[model samples]
Target: MSTSSFALRLMDVHVSLAGHEVLHGIDLSLTAGRWSSIVGPNGAGKSTLLKAMAGLLPVTGSIFLFDQTLMAMDRKQRAQQLSWLGQNESASDDLRVWDVVMLGRMPHQDWLAAPSAKDHAVVETALQATGAWDWRERSLGQLSGGECQRVLLARAMAVQAQVMLMDEPLANLDPPHQVDWLEQVRCLTSQNTTVVSVLHEVGMALHADDLVVMQAGRVVHQGPCADAVTHRAVEAVFGKRIAIHALDGQWVAVPKF
Candidate 1:
């Protein structure tokens, strides 16, 4: 396939933090309109890679988003094109849920301008999609962890970006919500929005269209979820402490014991 076929492409990407190299020279190309998960042991640079792709970390080398140079894009353009949901996001409990979600529309708003009718409409849609519309008037502090996560997800959805990067998005959610999260990802990809997430939940990560297994700051494998090589890659990363198995038409990694 042509290089342009990929939605996000990296060439020799590198990152260092506090005088320690977190990512060795890494290269990856993720197909557009698909959900891909990055999975690895802790400190394997999975989150670092996700942050690099989100432009939050200063890195060397090239990152292309939809064939456009990522760093060259203007701030407003970048905001409109890419949305990021960081790990363990925190918000003021005093704020109303509706207002929190409305924050996502800030990117599309003009300087110091109030929200337009379209902004309200988009926020409403996002809230509904995340199942947080019913609690729109409630304070964030009043909601449980799972409920709060839904509101946060609605906020991210309000950005309406073509590419969404999520770091451990399943945080604070229960199993049902985790399934809902997977469904939401599928829905986004169906709408031709690219999604790349860093997840610690191996079973959940397997639900993605593709898997990017990282080990020691490098991509050890990249392929379809059902690919045998991908399964092996997952096992290898965990040092065979876990095994990937096909179960009920899905891929999951289980404890070897």
Candidate 2:
């Protein structure tokens, strides 16, 4: 594939946390305009790998965003090209939901200048997309866990970045909201936005365009989600305790028991 066709690329990437390596020689290439879900059992280094891709952590090897070196980009340039939604993100409890989402536009704003009209429009659109617009005026402290997650999702969406990397984005969502999130992802991919997520829900991960399976800090498999080889790798990484099957023309994972 052409290098220009990749939204993100990593070469022999390695990350260490607290003096111990967590991600081992991760070489990944994420196609532009595709949704790629990363999956593995606990301690698989999924989050660490994601952080490295986002340039949030120090790494030993090369990472490229589009055709540019990730580390070489300035903070504002990186922010404009990539967005991140992390697990249990912390924002001030006193901040209104609208204000929180507006933070996403900072990278595009002039320092010390008020938000532009376009920023307001983008924030509103993101809030509506995540079903959080109704509570725009409410403070973060007033929302429940699931509600908070939606607001944070809106914040990430408001960035309108070319690439979005999310870690456990469905953390507190209900089944219906999870489906909604899936639809939102489809919409993003349709717009040619590259999405990478670390999903604990095997069934949900199967809905992605591609799957990256990791084991003990190493990537064991990467392929199209519908490929039987990908399913086998997923099951194998989980010790064959789960099985992937087709139901209603969609792949679903069920416990072996």
Candidate 3:
């Protein structure tokens, strides 16, 4: 296979937590500028896989980012190229939303340095992109669950990184807001930003360019999002309890019963 198009490649990657293995050896390659969605049942290690890719978890195998080993890159350099939005990210509730979003620029700033004009502009764009601009001056504690999720998304977007990893980004979002977030991700990918997301919503995962289906800590399926074989694998992993269907040109996973 031609590796030239891949941004990240994993070779025999394995991860363990609390002395119990979560991810079995996972070998995969993710293409640059493409959107990938990972789906699996509960405790299927979907989140673990994303964390490993983000270099947030301890793994024994090699993960090469943009042709460079993740281990070889310094922490700061890694931050310059990758951004992560974890599930239920904690924030200082008393902090203003703008200040919270500005935290994303820390990697680009010098010690004790003030926010630059560029930093402010980037934060503004990020906030607007996530529809969080109106709450810029509000306290984080004042926002609802869904609003907080958008603000956290804004912080991730402000990183200006080439690659982004997100876990359950739509957790607190309503249907309409979820659609908006999808559009935001589409726009980012158009700008050549690689996005890898872990989603429990199978229908939402279908919107990605590619799909990775996991079961028991291993990827059982990976291919074009609309591929029939991939859809079959998705059903098989769930013991055929959910049926994949096509409705109005969209794929949806509905319960078999």
Candidate 4:
């Protein structure tokens, strides 16, 4: 593959959490400027895998970001290379939405320095992109769950990093907002921003450029979304006693009672 087509490479990455092993020798290469989704049932290590890619967890193997070892870089340096949004992200209720979004600029900002005009511009653009601009002046506590989630997403997008790892971004979003997020992901991909997210929505995950199907602590399948064999692998990973079909152009995973 071309250099531009390969963004991050994970070689035998294994991670443990809370005294339990979660990821088991995971190996995958994520393409740059593309959208990749990881899907699995509970206890499948989906979040753990994402965190390992972001260097948030203690991993045994090497994770390379654009041909450079992520672990070899210092914390500040890695922060400039990768942006992350965890599943249970929480913001102080008293912080203004604008300020929270501006925090994304921290990696590029000097210690104790004030926000620059360019930073303000990026924050505004990110807010508008996530449809959270109207709530910019509001406090975090004033917004609902979905609204808060959008504001946090805007914060991550404002960072403008080349690679972004988000865990459960669709958590509090409604159906319309979920569609909006898909559009945003497409826009980011076009601009050469690689995006990888862990999702519980099977049908939505099927729409990604590539799918990583994890089961237990291992990645059972990783391939293009259009591969019919991959679809069967996905169904097998979930082990759902149901039919998987295409409904109105969207992949639907329906279960039978």
Q: What C-alpha lDDT do the candidate models reach, one value each?
A: 0.92, 0.96, 0.93, 0.89
Top model by TM-score, which number?
Answer: 2
| Clashing residue pairs found in predicted model 4 | none
**Candidate 4 lDDT, tens digit per residue, 1-257?**
96446889988988877888888888898998889999888899999899888888889988899988988988878888799999979899999999999999999899999999999999999999999999999999999999999999999998899999999999899999999999999999999899999999888887899999899999999988878877888888777555568888877778856
Model 1 scores worst on lDDT over the 10 consecutive residues at 244-253
Worst 10 residues of 4 by lDDT: 237-246
Q: Write the per-residue lDDT of candidate 3 for residues 39-92, one digit (tens) a residue.
A: 989999999999999999989989999989998899888998899999989798
Write candidate 1's Cα lDDT for 132-204 as tens digits.
9999999999999889989999999899999999999999999988988988999999999999999999999
Better of 2 and 3 by TM-score: 2
Stretches of candidate 1 off by over 4 Å are none
Q: Number of clashes in model 3?
A: 0
Pairs with backbone N, CA or C atoms under 3 Å apart (clashes), candidate 2: none
Candidate 1 lDDT score at position 196: 97
Residue 94 of model 1 has an lDDT of 98
| Top lDDT prediction, candidate number | 2
Q: How far is 202's C-alpha from truth in model 2 (Å)?
A: 0.4
RMSD of each: 0.9, 0.6, 0.9, 1.3
Stretches > 4 Å off in candidate 4: 2-4
Clash pairs for candidate 3: none
* Model 3 segments more than 4 A misplaced: none
Worst 10 residues of 2 by lDDT: 84-93
lDDT of 1 at 75: 87
